[model samples]
Target: MTRNAAFKVALIGASGLLGRAIAKELAGVAGWTLVRTAHSRRDAQSVKLDIRDAAAIGDFIGRESPDAIVVAAAERRPDVCENDPALARALNVDALRFIANAARDRDAWVLSISTDYVFDGSAPPYSPDDPPSPVNAYGRSKLEGERALLESGAKACVLRLPLLYGPVLDWSESAVTSLTPAIVKSSAPLAPAAVMDAWAIRYPTFTPDVAVVIRQMLGRHARGETISGITQWSGDEPMTKFDIAQRIARVLKVDARLVAQRTPADSTPRPRDCHLDSVRLEALGIGRRTPFDSAIASVLARYPEPTQTLKSQ
Candidate 1:
């Protein structure tokens, strides 16, 4: 299909952290129209297209005829996916396939946002070439989605983002938001998980940076390239849950002394070290990774008040 000068872009999950940031970035660009998705038609300019419904998606594509499509909707809760694998697959894997096929049919470029959970945590600093060995249901479902996109032969880019933090546009509370208050309260005596053995490192890119990268990729000429979006952090950098907590506490001016460190065996099954190397992204002229301390400060700057303490065991 011929490329259009004025690109019409469709973002599937425009309300989420990454999606919203991307939408904001795309909003400022000339010759780019962002069509955000909603669950219903009450919202103007939003097509009520559920990714799970292939027919609806196909129809939406034909109607909107966007030049680029970005799929960011997914059941991100790992434990919830484990409880119901079918639903997870439908949203994460099958839906992605439907979108990929639809994008291919319209000759539009597709970008799917993914996670670092695809790794089994056995290795540190995972490269894009590393074979995924997911240990949990969420990771498995995401892997399936990635495979479907590749197999469909669509012009696609799968970006594996590490932990992300940004300003809260909506007051919607999530696990990350819920834990921030507690971290702030205990900043004075910061005690975080001291799982030196349980190592999982990530660049933790800011949401705005991720959005800029996506915009660059979509506007660029490359197709069928998968890149990892992470910073250059080492697994042996003495990182742990405690280290992160301590940093957050420091940034937010919480009582670091109150922070306690512990390692419970029943914690979530995560990779010991899955820091992604963004050598490919750097080469592509995308901005460098955000500094870890700067990222933590940004998070704290958003939530200055600690109304309640995070329940610590």
Candidate 2:
């Protein structure tokens, strides 16, 4: 199905960071109507549906009968998922299967948002074909979700994204507000642990740019394509966590001299690098990846502040 053709589209997780951005993109476009679902009646036109409730999802699909479904919701917090593995599995894996099945039953196209965590992060700038070796529970669950969807024999596209920063619909209750404050507060002179040698590269796309790419991919002719939604930052220079923190400070014009370097032994185990190579998307003429500096500026521009920063004890 093409964008020019009128079709009904259902977007799950419409209240999330990426979901909200996708919803905004869909709103301005023609030939598509946004069918939003929430855990509760958060807004008008939103149906009360939890992804864990497969029966409810099936019922909703039968009722709304959208031509396409975008599964952009997932339990994204790694620590939270580690604490509640069952709940995470129910929502991230099982729920995705249910949505894929429903879309298939209705002969609708499916586009599910995934994450770069599917990889173990041992390799830098992972391509779409890289073997997944997830080290964390959250990563494993998301990998399971991707496997379930692919194995279902449905026409689906799994787009794996990196750390996302974007403007939220409810600014007062947005992920950025909650996370950024903690990030800023935690920004202090690097401690022994803070300088840990752990490393991970993130594409960190702007919400607006990612939303535009998703719209183009779904509304255009890229069905059955498993694309990576990360930008190519130098194609070789992988940014470490310390590097990211330093850059964040620099973009905000804050004193980054105190941002110290540490080893992975001081903190939790994390992937050293997981930057994605978006050659496929670029080849398709979708959109180029936003520069790291440019993306940071965009995020900081949306949220300027003298907020309390979180300090790690």
Candidate 3:
């Protein structure tokens, strides 16, 4: 709470998973007035915003002139980006440059949310200092966005996150959303009996935990502190997708037969191991993270299980 010193905040993509979590966290906190905006899903309270439109973005920012702007919106699906490289560049690259430039003119610091996919998976446990080697269009576009922000000569922070799965608008909205058997339509997900990337490692971060760090970062800025440059906030536990699937079944009291299927080869080339190392974040005194398994049940409580599973006794 920056008590008695209120500041305006413009949160882009307030309707999405991580965006909604951040909105919820900042709702009643002192010294902050949230101006929510979402594309195609605007409610009565939130302003409708399409980042692709430069005039619209300029208009909104000019009207609000917020103290800080947090960009949680993105075209995140890898396959989707791969299919349409133009759309990917438009949303992930161009829109960010527009935002950064506009925010720079108004002297507002920007906090752009990024991902671990920015790195090539050949390495394990990436740090903030690691150079990005994006193999896919999605990663390439995001890496470009990072460069645009840093080069925009504006006060900006790039928080690169890892594979995210928490409460979602729809079951398929998030990659990790289908990990539970209740929502799975088949006896098992079309995965390999012996998971190919058994050695491939990753850190699955929970959204609310990320929101906590964002809030702290915002609070610090409100108190007149600087948070420039890149930071990594990942799950404490490092595990494979197979490991995650097994844990989801265990915690939800469902069958773990899904882990037995052969891993399906992805059409798009994925980084083999992009585990984000969070020692820098810890050293900087960021938020404490909940272990992946520990956070599973709580996230599960939000979404209703499928009425029935396809598998029969």
Best by TM-score: 3
Q: Can you give the lDDT of residue 110 in candidate 2?
A: 76
Give the per-residue lDDT of model 3 (tens digit) for 1-313.
2435578789998877788788888898875899999997667768999999988998899999988999998889999999999999998989999999899888888999999999998877788998899999999999999999999998899999988877666666566665553323333567333232344566888888999999988878888776889988888687776777777666666554543323436788778779888787687687868777777777766446532122310
Candidate 1 local lDDT, 201-271, one digit each (tens): 43445777788778877767333343422222121233555566666667766554443334334345766
Q: Best by lDDT, which number?
A: 3
Candidate 2 global CA lDDT score: 0.68
**Model 1 regions lying over 4 Å from their true place:** 1-4, 40-45, 169-177, 185-199, 222-239, 257-267, 302-313
Q: Provide TM-scores for the models.
A: 0.82, 0.81, 0.89
Look at candidate 3 and give me any clashing residue pairs.
Answer: 191-261, 191-262, 191-263, 192-261, 192-262, 192-263, 193-260, 193-261, 193-262
Model 2 C-alpha lDDT per residue in residues 1-313, reported as the tens digit of each score: 4434466788998867777778889887765678887774246756778898889889999898877788878888877788899988998899999988887888777778877777777766788888889878888999899888877766677887777766643333333333344345455566222231224454456777788877887656324343322222112235555666666667766543333444454233456567777777777887645676776566666454422121200
Considering lDDT, which of the candidate structures 1 and 3 is the better prediction for this target?
A: 3
> If both were scored by TM-score, which would come out higher, candidate 1 or candidate 3?
3
Name the 10 consecutive residues with the lowest summed lDDT in model 3.
Answer: 304-313
